[model samples]
Target: MSGSTATTTPQTTIRIPAPAVTALRDALLRPDGRERVAFGYCSRSGNDLLLTEVEQVPDENHRHSSPGSCRPTTACEREFISRCTSRDLHPVFFHSHPFTDTAWFSTLDRQLIDRFRKWLTTLYPDRDLLFGVLGHEEMRIERVTADDSRPVAVDIKGEWELEQPVRPTHTAAPDAPAVDTERFDRHLRAFGEAGQTKLANTHVAVVGCGGIGSILAQTLARLGIGKLTLIDPDEIEVSNLPRLPGCTHGDVGQLKVSAMHQRCWEANPDCDIISIARPVQETEDYLKNADIIVAGVDRVTARYWVNQFAVRHLIPYVDAGTVIETSDADPPQIESMEVYIQTIVPGVTACFDCLDRGDPDQAYRESLDSAEEKAAVERGYIDADIEPEPAVIDLNQLAAAHTVSAVKRLALGTQPPVAFRKYDDVSGDQALLETHPNASCPTCLGNSLALGDSTISSAADQEIATAPLDDAALANPLEQTDRTTRDWFPPAVTAFFASDLAQHPTTDP
Candidate 1:
């Protein structure tokens, strides 16, 4: 994946879909005591490197293999590269060392990487390369640039656990003191210091600082979440005072996120809160870094956009909403009151599109320019006056509570990562429904899944495409380096494996 490399030290994080993780383990970690190779395709979005698909090399096609040496047939390597270039995706090379539990690149591994890097640069000068060494217990990834290869964070997007030994180079703020407060004594007692620490290290983005969102922000703060980002564009109204937290008649015209920020600080003064008083679309850079996203917006259009964003970036998203339907009779009477919470674990769970819950028409109308929207309204494509939806604080609270519970489960790994629950006030019962993602979902499957920043058109893409190449690695990403004394295997073996394959002509998949 090649893009505009950050002038600042780039902190790269790798996100692999759950199924791709399974495929890698099953294909490369065979019971037989021998090394194996595989390849995957990925995209670079901002600081994230997302893997979308994985392909294993069949044993019959290997040119050579042993406990410490492995190499795919020349055809296999060429085919993999072809597929990646054809799809505008980057190739991620993987090799497993079943002999050990710890993973690190060997001298031979570096040699092979450099050869491929030099070869690929000749084919596509601006392209980037990624190489990984997989061990039984841990994995190591190297981000190949024109100048040097550095370690990057490799995190699985779903429930399956993978240990990443190398940490990315991202500066973190000072440790939060919220978890050590006397106010969270009971909370610490419930989950222990380690759990509290996990919450403290987490950063959550709560979109839509309205009834449910305000409650979520305050509750997350009180629960010791170290960082909170409150996002919304609306201002408080007289009608919103009852449902909004820390709001009064005097603050009726202020931005909802500002009031929610104050409310969260009062709940836990040590918690860091950022108020983004703008539409969610304009805040992708902030949202991409969040460990979790909580969507509390009222419209399906907004929810749909959030879901799409979450799926593309492989961010966990929790969606919460409340519905209060009333009869349009002489004297309106309540028909139903319901609270719903859906937890989306990117590749692991069903998305808004899979659930068929998003209104494409409404989303389209919202995406239109003001004049276009007016034309649409005049054309009878949408309602000229959309009546305000009925909302009650009690129901919003119930939704917020459930949504927070889902967030807790995700943060603590206390349960399955996926959930869809509903509470019906009239029926006096709650139901937990199973979610199944559509096989053909455009948002969370195939080419779009885990595409990262490249999935959306942006100025960065143009910058990367036209940026001047400043280093030879930009022309040839991997570097050929000297051998080390700590070779796990003989140098002769590594040399044969690295040079023998490149001699053959390239072939297509």
Candidate 2:
């Protein structure tokens, strides 16, 4: 009689969810524990498998067995196997590794595997049963056979290093919209055929998915940005509904990155969206590959992280913020709404530190003072006491649109506006402040280009770049200033009035 040997294909290894690992570790720590240590295996989906449930095994505690020993009762075994089969999950043999250093498997481990093999063979003769060795420091997986053989260690490290799963290219759902080839062509042209080629190969990271960020992402997607990494831990709140487009009431508790991914896909299906639902600290690897970073976060902590990351990587970062205020005493009186846009080109523009060092409280103080002034106006006049209706959606949308336009201009090699535009509805006039970098700005003092080998010689040794201002022509307000004036209109004003007689000739200011 001739005998044939059966060989099984190697099982693909995947990362166990961190939570599940923690749960298993916690289970092993119990002492008088009748706790049922349930184990089930499912094929890897994306990063990890969803651990469905764990049922408690009663009166099955093995006190005499090793601390890690998972000697499930006959009933528990049958129940586990039944549930796994119903859920189409495989019954990887389950055993506990007591928190000990002994490298070799105990005799009990072999006996338990033998018992499980007998049952697994009857149910899945062709398939191998997986065995998990859960220890204090590590967890090991192996395969078992019916011949009362020792388990084979699963190579976890080797498997995890393999490339990501190759998903079908056209796996998009049937209801998904068809590709817009014409818009794609237009996007390519707008980014410059050569530029679009470069951008397609580049990866961009957006730190926040708020008002400015949402629009920024939309613009990038429409521009055919090849790869995008979105990092945000916030959920869509009711307060954010007015500013955040593409978000609905249903998305109130949903992750910002998920919402952003949906919007990006709808904007451009070809663009890749890497959604990171965790905080920025937890997603450094995603930040490492970013070619350009768009900072639309309102928090100082988040902005600091972005600034540090951008400075370290020499990546260009565009920062945008808008402040809207209304007087308490005046109805329809917009106290002031100032919009600030700053572009920090790694080696070119002064870093944020440089600007902050000069006048640390300048921006914050200015914003606060403006807000207070608006509040005062609202409180001073009895007519203003009447509460003004909340801002309309169009106002926030208008701000976001301008911000997105600015980002596009920067990406297209156009110089971004440096003047902070203050729209004052009460005075019916707009104030423009030329936000020039202070020579003593601390942020810029020690800044050295990331790409260059040269280091900053000394804080005082750095030279400041200055541009000449044409103050003489603007001195006479009666006479029209240069025709090339950028108007900063107040909220309720009809006519554009030049605030100062002098026009700054140099673009630096």
Candidate 3:
């Protein structure tokens, strides 16, 4: 009678079907001998590993051949996880190392293991899972339990027993609505739908297809932007994948514009994707057709060029930049992620020249000068000689995102941020929207902020006198200086003074 009262415990053994393993092997062997293996596990009770839900390790190829190096690709990882989630499968990824016999895991390998354990614990603390790390000839298995104890190895009958290729299910592509459908549907019913329709009709142009530009293009595409024009002269590089969205290791060496076009189209086939694989200077004509232009460039020279084009064509240009400086500590720490966003609406707010001058080197020098001396000057200084260093991708992307948000605000006819906005280092996040009434700015001369009557009259007089008096006039240096000063000074000075000149005229005039 006592023996008849035995109780049963739940079994935790995970089974990976045989057919799935074969498919994974085939997939890993494709694209010549270079292809690598990756897999995911799915389970309902949140304990058994579902081999049907597998994924290719992101950035796995780089460290695949090495013992402990790995760089995961975000797009690939996201794609893998999304597909699995859609099928109601939990994620447990598998990747291979090319080494034949590496007993100890490398730093990268340990880091990856640590990351996976942490992620699983955070997402599913009650679920037990297993992570597999396959070597060139040996397979290693590590089991993760609900408790934070050491992972133990489990022996399988065969190495390739659970290898199977799982293809992503095909579904009809969803329509991209212009508006914020998620938030709208969640909040307002009819108005949100209507707003989305309006958003679908907007078009955007991104200038610069490097790190920031590429990511911006993808974001806009995914957000269901109606039309997009991507411009860039450089080709993709292997190093760009770590930062740029929609790009893979395979995309390296391809034209950035072309890659972006392909990727955007893939993301939202209905959205228009135009490619301009040339410098912005060469594609000025195309820019006129855009409703909004985003400048995700590195050079101040390029920014100035964009500024001129945007001003001339009355296009809303959003300029973004990042300045990264390391501290002088034993282990250098990034001083700050100095992200900046400038929205230039031709006749609305202060243009780039009105916010601040384009020369960052000059700004840096000014920052270093004695505070008393720097403050004593009435007219702001200009460093015609300062050349800024090349900008990096993180700063560029952050700035681009800010610029896109600003554009969205403008497109929606919301109160756009004041004309000139600067997010200097983090502390300077305040929006400054001052306008210049008497600004003799070469950039915005005929627009919202007109030059003073005296400045205009002076300019007219100089133009008439220097109006090409035949070859004899060209021989005088004074004539050259006069013409050059007239043409360049107002713009240069306007940039230095920002919107301050609108309050009071420069005494020098």
- The top-ranked prediction according to TM-score is 1
**Model 2 C-alpha RMSD to native:** 26.0
- How well does model 3 score by local distance difference test? 0.55
Q: Of the pair 1 and 2, which is ahead by TM-score?
A: 1
lDDT of 2 by residue, 1-47 (tens): 00011112223333232333445545553554322254654432222
Ranking by TM-score: 1, 3, 2
TM-score against native, each model: 0.80, 0.43, 0.45
Ranking 1 against 2 by lDDT, winner: 1
Clashes of each: 3, 21, 14
Local distance difference test, each candidate: 0.77, 0.52, 0.55
Candidate 3 residues lying further than 4 Å off, grouped into runs, are: 1-191, 328-330, 360-397, 424-438, 446-509
Kindly report which residue stretches of model 2 are placed more than 4 angstroms away from their true locations once superposed.
1-181, 188-192, 330-332, 357-399, 409-439, 447-509
